[model samples]
Target: MFKGLKPIQYAGREVWPLIEGGKGVSATNHASSGAWAAAGGIGTVSAVNADSYDEDGNVIPQVYEGRTRTDRHQELIDYAIEGAVAQVERAHEIAGGKGAININVLWEMGGAEAVLQGVLERTKGKVAGVTCGAGMPYRLSEIAKQYGVYYLPIVSSGRAFRALWKRAYHKVPELLGAVVYEDPWLAGGHNGLSNAEDPTKPEDPFPRVKQLREMMRKEGISDDIPIVMAGGVWFLRDWNDWIDNDDLGKIAFQYGTRPLLTKESPIPDIWKDELTKIEEGDVLLHKFSPTGFYSSAVKNPFLRSLQGRSERQIPFSTEKAGEHTHQLDVGVKGKNFWVAAGDLLRAREWDGQGFTTALKTPDNTLVFVTPEERAMIRKDQADCMGCLSHCAFSSWKDHDNYSTGRLADPRSFCIQKSLQNIAHGADPHENLMFAGHAAYNFKTDPFYSNGFVPSVKELVDRILTGD
Candidate 1:
């Protein structure tokens, strides 16, 4: 159907019209990417925390004892590199004789160089390209050139693209394969929010993609440099104007969420079913992450917990003399609970809602909840053998000097622990499932066959042909 489209040369290999966006954890694994590449398109295997598994599919021992975030982050990177190498080898074997395989990297994640180096060394020339996001990857071109691989940076705006071009594109122009313009609001995972951009404002991605093409041209990058459009892209018919058009320049569509419903996608069935049944407005962009960035996901029971917590919170200040000394006594004798008026009222509300139980700590801090909830929290904490450097769930830390410093925050849960659980078919309601806003279309889309999952080739054909 897209016969007029010419094959673009990237990393010295030709690829088809499709480009699969890299998903984190085991979501976007080698099997899925290899299937996409086997269809003559580009497949990106997510390498974030890539070295998470050992040769026997078991999690390797993490060296970080929660002492230092920096030290823990480094250890995580080493493990990620090892894991990525294993994934690449598996993907190459599956690619068989189709298109090429690419590795996806998060710039903000630690051990970017080490992970890439390990994968490249193991795969040798089998690795075709590297796609990076999460931050401005200014050194991508330089790194890609060293290994004779193509580099594509994911950006949300033309200005961001130009900044990278002026700094690095001038030197390794050939290494630049394409510019991926991911819709910050529509795509899943972490979004690229500008300082001035409002989260409520829904910006049209078509104009932005065109704007990026013009900016690339101004920077000496030609029309030949493809612009891969991601996020909210479901059907080619919705973007017919972009294809075979001179004004928009050469373009390709990147799918991040839709691919999850395909047979080759590694997401658990529970996750796919949730995406299939999601309502139009169910996905929300939230700011609860410690990374201080907005993340997109379904507004399920998991998200409701965070929302409820946010709504009940009230600001407390010890500024005024009269406001500083007032305290109310509640909970057990040894564990006394002292809280502001607002906190008491919220606790009462929770108590009335069957979450009855209150405890006062030796430090005079008050926490309210049910005995069952407390037991579950304790179980979750006990199960945590130190996933993150200093988890808020178990209060585990790598260092000893700091209280909350060395201890995990009781308020926050371990993301890795919960996400891994959900990814492996655990109860979806108990864990967070991140997805793009376009996930709702799966319900009505005829191509999905009422959530009857198709293979990667079938899904890609539907996207290209608009069936």
Candidate 2:
């Protein structure tokens, strides 16, 4: 049904209107990317920990081996680059005779430039463009030009677009293909939600897209440069009014969560079922991340556990200034419960529930709960393969020193280990599951069969035809 659509010029290549948003970990892979490209549009393959595995699913050799954080990060860079190149080659092969293929990069991730260079140098002319987000990719234009590929920056506002254009647009003018406007409130993964933009106030995207288009034109950016709309994009009918409009003449739609249901998507069936049964308030945007940014995810047992921990925590002062700080003797052998009067009741409640295990971190801070839960946490830590550059749970970092300076926060977990587990069909109740708010629609949408599976073509066609 996407017939008769005019070709949009992107990085010297004519591409279709569809652009698939990149999802990390194995969610958005070469198969799904190739399928999207096969539809004559731009398909983005995620490169987060790209060098994570080889064709046979084996780990590559460490590129660096030093105690320092910089050294460790450097090694990670080399591995990621090699992995990205492999993924790109696979995607290129699958694209076959289809349209252009693009790579998605997370600027916040360690070794961003090295990984990009690795993919570009290896792929050479095979890749058409690179899309970067998670941070303000100030040097993206420079990198894209060096590799001779188009660049697309995912932005949330017109002001952000203007700022990037003024800083780096001149050097890579020809390479600026499109601007992805991801709705901070509606999208999954790391959100761009600002302090002022309340989650309660859901803004219509059409007006925002129009504003960005006008801002682009003011900055001498041509009208031909498409503004790709992402987040909460379920069906074409939801965006019918935004499409083919004068203000947003050349527009494209990017799908992040909806693509997970497709056959080409790499997520397991168990995770897909969770998305189907999710309710309206089941998806939450929380500020618990140590990155100091908001993230969206399902309110499953994993998330609820964290929420409960936050609620039960109390401030303790060394001075004898508070009424709550009291040394209390415990019946358990060789254990003392340092409880505030307020926390005393909570501790008693846990004790009545038969929770006897109390674990302490390196800082000597205690978290008293159930032994069974602690064992699960310990198992999750043991299974960690050091996916993220630094993890609070395992205290694993690219360097000997804390890279993000957040190794002690109980609020943070090893994202890599948890995501990998969930993606591999591990216990959904324990592992964190990232999803868009529109995930709940899976239950009502006829496009999904039994809330479990749908072919890539079917999902894409449903999006294009608004079914």
Candidate 3:
């Protein structure tokens, strides 16, 4: 029997199957989350460097005044805690006891555990659940249990869930709220694409999530436990068979891209305008993140620049051997290095075109760049703030003498700088715009045909009619 989408118990309150996925750098803020909660759905507050407001509700820029990289890292932690606390407080007031609020964090972010503990301790009884992803978050359950809040671990495959359940999540099953299976190929933001998986080949999430449910059921978890499907979900009618199917068990849908156009969305007006104009394939999935993970972003000029940089790369050998016939003309010539004969002409052309500096990557390849670009890359690397547990860009590990013992990678960029700039009204084309593949639908969706931006309540109502 089809009863349509209805409310269900989540973290102590009955709420709709709808959930607003958390976006970092103040994209999902208090006003937007509060409005979602008021609409009888779970709202997520992004605890990843959330922004704090001034007395007049203006966003206060996060300026670092520290003299050292480690000092700046501490400043970042303080900012994360204070901003998350403020957002949670506002969300609680706006909810007015109607719906629940969940805090979202990335396990790979620098000082993730410390930020979670700090925010949870300060905002007692305010947050209902914690959603975490972007690495094996084994300690997430334990931390949530300590604070008496539900925990949702986001994974891309069944093997990941089985591993987490066998290791730590099984020990704290009471507060386990839901399992979020984010599609690696189609999802926005940081993807969980494993080594065995091909990024170019996308898989259907139906079978993947069903297998996850089977694994959970085998682990003694009830069928009532909802599996929230995130990434590439736009219309509920498109997923009719998944709603009440006995095989998939209880289900929910989460939207990270749809809410960006809503009235309460905190992003700049330029971002909203740009979203409407985005075409299919404008968003790209690439490996440019310093966290050594695959992430999806708009293929704007900023992303294109990175792609061009990688294209200019070529493999080289320290000494000439079999098939290593051409001498590297752009680099130290007397070093006995060799490159492919075909690449020698290209390298010479690039060098003649003022791209005189060559930087070596961890993969034993050399990337040629202009002197000015080379200087900028070095400066950005020197200003590393330890934003990730381990960064491939600056080679700054949070611990172990604060170095990964590897050369800084030029293929990746500092995510913190770009996200912050974009969130605070910078150019979207110049920043990394994370979005699901279905984001292109905004152009044709009748609801947004006439430049109409719905309120959170309006969006929820529209979603309820199965439109």
lDDT for model 3, please: 0.90
TM-score of each: 0.83, 0.85, 0.97
Highest TM-score model number: 3
**Which digits, one per residue and each the tens of the lDDT, describe model 3 over residues 226-273?**
999999988888889998898899999998999999999999999999
**Model 1: which ten-residue window has the lowest total lDDT?**
328-337
lDDT of 2 by residue, 1-467 (tens): 54334567664556667788888766787888888887777888888765356568764543445455455556666666776777778888888867778999877665677678878888887788888877788899999989888899988888788888888876678889889999988889888776778877878878888899999888778877889988888877767777678987688888888888777887887787677788777888886553446788889998888887655444433334456466533323442445577666666566677555545544434555576766766765554444454456656554456344533455456676576567776988788788888888878777665545766666666666665
Give lDDT: candidate 2, residue 136: 82
Write model 1 residue lDDT over 1-467, tens digit each, in one string: 74455667665567776799898777888879989988888888888765356658765644456455445555666677777777787788888967888899877554566667777767777788898887788888888888888888999999888898888867998878888998888988878888888899989887888889888877788888889988888877787778888777888878888888888888788788877788898899987543346778889897787665445333333233333333433323332234566676666677677656553222234455567756765666555543333344555543463224433333445566566677677888878788898888898787776448999988777666664
- TM-score of candidate 3 against the unseen true structure: 0.97
Order of models, best TM-score first = 3, 2, 1
Between 2 and 3, whose lDDT is larger? 3
